[model samples]
Target: MSRRIRVPFVLLLLVVAAVAPVGGAAATGSSDAGTVDVAGTADLDGTADADVTPDTAAGIATNHGGTIVRTTTFSLTPGEPGSVDATMRFDLPDGVPELTVGPFPDGVTVVDEGGFDREGDRYVRRDHGRAALTLRFDLPSEQLSTADVGIDTGDWAYVRVPYVPTEWSYYGDAPAFRGDAAVDGEGAVQGEWAYLGATETTTRSAGDLTVRYVRAAGDPDAPSPDAVFAGWNWLATRLGSGGRDRVTVFALPTPDAMEWRRSPGLASDEDGAAYVFSRAPATGTEPAWFHEFVHLLQGPEPSEGMEWYPEASATYYARLAALNLGASEYGTFREASTVEEPRNVRFTRRSSWRSPTDYRQGALALGAIDATVGAASDGDRRLADAHRRLRDDDRLTYDSFRDAAVAAGNGSAGAEADRVVDAPARHEFVDDGLAYADHAPDRDLDGDGLDLATEREHGTNPFLADTDGDGLDDPAELDRGSDPLAATRDADGNDDGEGSADEPDPKTVDSDGDGLSDVRERELGTDRKRADTDHDGLADGEEVEGVTDPLDPDTDGDDLGDGEERESGTDPLAEDTDGDGLPDGHEVHVGTDPADPDTDGDGVPDGEQHREESESDGEDVPTWSPRGVGEMVGDLVEDALELPRMVADVVRLLT
Candidate 1:
């Protein structure tokens, strides 16, 4: 019985190149246009059944296994034509598996493939995996030159196999294989071909996958070739030289064709070719591009038991790349994944596996590893070095990866790796690592009390303490319920229903209408909304302009208000003006000039004369006239006697 296993969704979109068979060199001949021809065939049908074991039969038996033969010919001589021919033979030697073939290039004309139903760009052979057929097509030289393939039709072709490689364009695992070759009539020399072992072979996984691009003609919806190249270039630079050098990216016309859940659902070739199903531009901004590109930088997992590492690393780097390229902000990627998932499940445990949750948690684990490595090495090494070690090592396994990490960061990295890998779920250590990767520390770049990450999220300028140029800093603005992103307007512009008539907007100009702007109030350390900040009966603006302390009601401590002192032309900071003994306010209230000690020019001082009169009369008299007190008293008595007689005369007249 054929037992076909469902392919992993991510792997279906990946097309990895075949590692050359043991002792075989990769194809390395250059044509005038740098083009070469490649041909291969895989007979997955039961006719070539070698093993019915659980491992080999799972992919072939359950799924409708079929045979696929393909040939591609192109020139390296810049501006040359190329061609691709594929034959799909189907049958269910045991029973019909749902056999389908060829998401063939767009504009391909079918020639002599009998009894096959055409469905879009693909050829369908149903009710059996048993059949033989051939397909033929032509490729233009200009189309071949660009990095994008299938641009005309918005889809590319792929042959379904039991297991697909993560890289693009490699067909090494095809059941019965024919080597790569040059076209029959082309002047190109036949390139070398090798049948690398199946995906189960961990011994010979060192070599990189070869990539090629194909696209549909005149497809306006396709991403620009330049953008695709730039994105790849950025990814390559990030991964460093040890990463895969050659990759082919096929830009699909629509997103539907690239859906993971659909039929003919392969998004990548066994070789390092990718099928991008986005209608948006293929710039680095697209997270999907980064996600797939990261796969090329990943080395093979150490063992079947450790298969999650590759996927986890890919997931982690996708977000990292986006952040590095400024396509996304810090914490965005982690928030989406780690925030919702359970924190206590072992990532490697089968029962703990959840679609995106597991993926995100695994990424966190990798991030922790990266941080540990970086920290231990004092930034002298990084996670990339560990990956490079994995690529260079002959054995790929969890232990190998751990050893590499430990070596990269000395002994410290090993403990960190264990802490992440063995934990049931995420921990604070993981969060710290993720934060470290994001450069989230105690950094308040603007000294606004908000960290750089928060500043970025709130749209506040990290370099400027006051993002809006408001009188308040960003933190103060937040505390005051003001927008750090918007500048504080003048009083006339403030109508957001926050401040009342009595309390003007502190951020506005002349907030208190005291002739001082909010900026000036801040400079003078006065309340912006209160005309008399210190309740000294003087406007803050006037006090500030007059060089008096707005915060102090009694600037001179002379029993005089700042406003009264200013009105009297007395120094507000000094209690005595013009050597007067009386207080400034007291002198002004008594109708005496505070600036002059003796207004009448008497020999005695004004304060001394007043004191002597009070002592002599035994009364609290503020001032005494120059005439004698006896004359004053006589005038007072005469006025009183006259008032009584006048009253008696009025009473007699009334009677």
Candidate 2:
């Protein structure tokens, strides 16, 4: 219950501080997908290639050895309050590539183009030498500065319009460059969040994911990039995402609060970019930036049924990430997950969504599924496991979600998932710590100092004390750097049984058959391998149960231990066995029966005699003297015999 930050956590904080943010550069690059997706709640076609390493600069073409498959140049001009002017140029050396453009959400006009004819929804550039394209963005439909694509302030332009890099046919055979595409980045910026102005950017990396923050030159009051990076690192690591090369987070700072809506931000998973206003969320509980940042990790193929998934996951993961970082409490998370919407409206109608019910309730279902699977597995898996499955599947459904849960946990877990999916908290319980203590096996049944959840998390058996048969319990194995799941070798790769020779028997919790387990023995500083640690007639188990000192043979500091006083019975925890005003230990020391009040039975109790002797050294207090009392009894017996003889003599004389 005493919570102190562990050494590893302290070291992680230090690491986060060590990788400080630096002033960097920002560039422009457009993500080429079949369809255009905005940051609010839309989706693009392609999922990011996690393996592809970007140039570390924001939107530079991905580096795959060296090859030239496609080249694009993007230039942006800061225009009106909510729009920007952009120009895109591409070098078409070999053949004419598909130049997809236009059909934007109104307010976008094709200002000019060198050699292109307008097709139905796209522009057809017939020439192959060089293509020049320009467009004016007046995103009147978007809220002040919320859109990720075309956001223009009075002085700076921050946008990631797919139209910017008009052609992305080369990004793959890799997303920005195709086969042997030795792409050249001249004065162009890189990454999804492009800042068009004479302003420097800042880049920070946590794990493998790097975030480039684009700001107008010398904009102070930005949150320390490291502060946010650490949270992302914790969440991403838990989700099994290592380093994800680099992503862009364009932090647009508003001097006047009225300039942009509070906490306005958006992210593109395809482009790995998030453009958010530098302001806290309305309520601190929901962090808008974290929510936007989490969007970079997820991309759902737009299907009709689970349309609410991306938003739900983002919302839940943002809260979860905060919870794990200690920024929020578990109650908040659980409450947020609890469904308040109508059961039929939310659960029955999959296609239709009602805000809190569909998104928040869906999150709750995910939370419940995670808890069930994690508890069933003893903590080896989480919702992220199922999430990865859902993310990979072409179509998302309750059945697929159920299958993923079952695969991650077990059949029962999947059933729990379905039960929760249908209605919140119906059949199974939910706990982030995986507290399935009431389950059949019972948590910590083996009593090896680890709970069932911890054992399952470590791949150890919940029922078995020694999972690896390594003569050490799982916890002891871990302490000695031995693998809890492997027994063939020790921590140092010593296979000759040398490491386990001195350890207690891991085969049983009570190695020495004492009532206390080995772990408990160690805690009490008792010898776990010895049943009688104190070497008294009483076993250590009995001593502990009786609340006597296990380290001392005489628990009450009495000279006579229970073994010596067993013939007549004695209290090991009590000083006076007979309660005759003398300690049992003193009676034994003074040559008297400790279990009895009288040793000689001369009408003087032995304890009283000892007390009297101690008071007068046997020279005074005759009433308390044992020898004097014995002589007096002998004389009384002699007088009785003489009286009987005299009575017989008197009767003879009368006759």
Candidate 3:
């Protein structure tokens, strides 16, 4: 299979050769006289022609050739996609001209070839051929390129991209993005910021957003003067609700400065007290301002028993939005998997796994929940739909959100949630093996009196029927082309009774759908559902994940996906192979020499013997590192001492 998309958007190759300056080579035809027509004539037809002028108001125009010019610029807008529109005008100088435009680039789509709308000053040229050769075209939004824009004269032409961004427009309003703040008049009003809860605390509204900044009323250093104004701009941007939602930021500079000094009674921080202000902004590290603004819109965490789903859902939304907008570096949310966990010393005492694992798994569970619900609703009740229902229709409690999701999926308010039943089992893998056992809920799958729940209690794996009493699960056998009920057979058709089937075991499924199997994912130090093991938010399974061939790294020969090695700071091929603090290539870059442990000036390497020499006088021996090695050595020494031949030699020497 080809690794890259067959219809690649861009292609560039280097050729070692000398060529004459453009237009110096030939002039087989003139603009006034007839010329052969080809697709791309904009960038490479002539020497600097006279200034052609644009008849219309939208694009720039040059006068000499009288050719109308247009350009395209890509933006960080979603849903509106991307597109290019241009109208070319060539004023034929009373000459019979057979003008040809040729050699269009790959993937350059022509949406409309003729005139579209005719407005007052700049309207469509219905019949440009009669006056001049005017060609109007619309480029595909998803794929934009100049490869198609080549120059073609009657007999000769040149190659270069000529389209420029003279006038750009989107189908719908563009949403706010990171750079939106940089736009003029988009910043805070009145050089000074309003302080929350301080004397300057006030309510203001702009565009569909309401802004409120509250500092502690009694505190002297309640709110900074600048934060309040920035907050207003943030609110306005979010409420605009077009391309990307903006937010009003709330900044608490110190631990004691927040309005709410105490942790309120709530389930998770995602669903914690939203109405109250915090001494510090909520979790998230980059661009410090946006994270807190999202929390402000979160309002207060839903009252106990009320719906708190929005808190977590909104946080998820902000995180995804930030990623899409390029506001935060990739992998910013890797460690936020378990949302509601508290920050106590004991909370960190779980088995030796990292925090990002939990966050990724937890987030994936939420995504799966959304998917399950969306599937049930035939696409009507989406994740956003569920959120709306929770706040508007239901009372907004844990039970309420759960019921809404279940109802949306089953198309009934009281329909039994068989899917929900599997969640507890699934949670065990994600939540560090801490969950209830599997319990198939009572659900009528077949019209017969028997239920799936009853079958689970008595039947074997549903996909695999393994009735013959073989140890392998039927699904496992079918995966390996062996009969599940029959004696286990290896690839050679031998009844080996060893190793499970060639297929992976199903128990260790990934929580995220990133494609890394759970067991291998864990062994390889990665999220099972996510191929990108580093929680950098990219998938290693996809060629895009910084691994060229997610399946076969050796195939690319680069030893890394151009993306993975360039971005995530991990070796694309090896995992901790060098035993350096950094991954292999990184160590190589820092000159620490990945293969050598003692790259430093120090004499000792990093293993047990070196460690022993470096420890303090009273330090205990590192038993965990040396136990097995020491015991095996002691046994060998004792055996050597007891050798009868050696003992006899010693006795003779003494006599």
Cα lDDT computed for each candidate against the true fold: 0.48, 0.53, 0.33
Candidates, ranked, lDDT: 2, 1, 3
**TM-scores for candidates 1 onward, in order:** 0.41, 0.49, 0.25
Off by over 4 Å in 1: 1-85, 88-215, 238-245, 255-269, 280-286, 427-655
Model 3: residues with Cα > 4 Å off, grouped in runs: 1-208, 214-311, 338-364, 371-381, 397-423, 426-655
Better of 1 and 2 by TM-score: 2
lDDT of 3 by residue, 1-655 (tens): 0000011111111221323121111112222111111221122223222222223345443222233232221112122322222233332221112233322234344333333343332323322232211232222322112233322211111112232111111111111101000101111211011111122344555335554444333434444535434433443343232222232222322323222333211111111111223333322322223333434333223433232233334344444434323333233433444344432211111221234433333334445455444434433454434443553431334555566666556532212222222222132112210011112235332222434344333222222234224555444454565433335445445452455334333433444556554444445443333355332334654543344444333332333334545464444556444453344544444334445655453544433323454643433223243545776786587467657754775674333
Alpha-carbon shift of residue 588 in model 3 (angstroms): 60
10 residues in a row with least lDDT, candidate 1? 195-204
- Flag the better candidate by TM-score, 2 or 3: 2
Over 337-374, each residue of candidate 1 has an lDDT whose tens digit, in order, gives 45453566565443445455545667777777786676
Alpha-carbon lDDT of model 1: 0.48
* Per-residue lDDT over 92-132 for candidate 2, one digit per residue giving the tens place of the 0 to 100 score: 53322334444554566677866777776567664445665
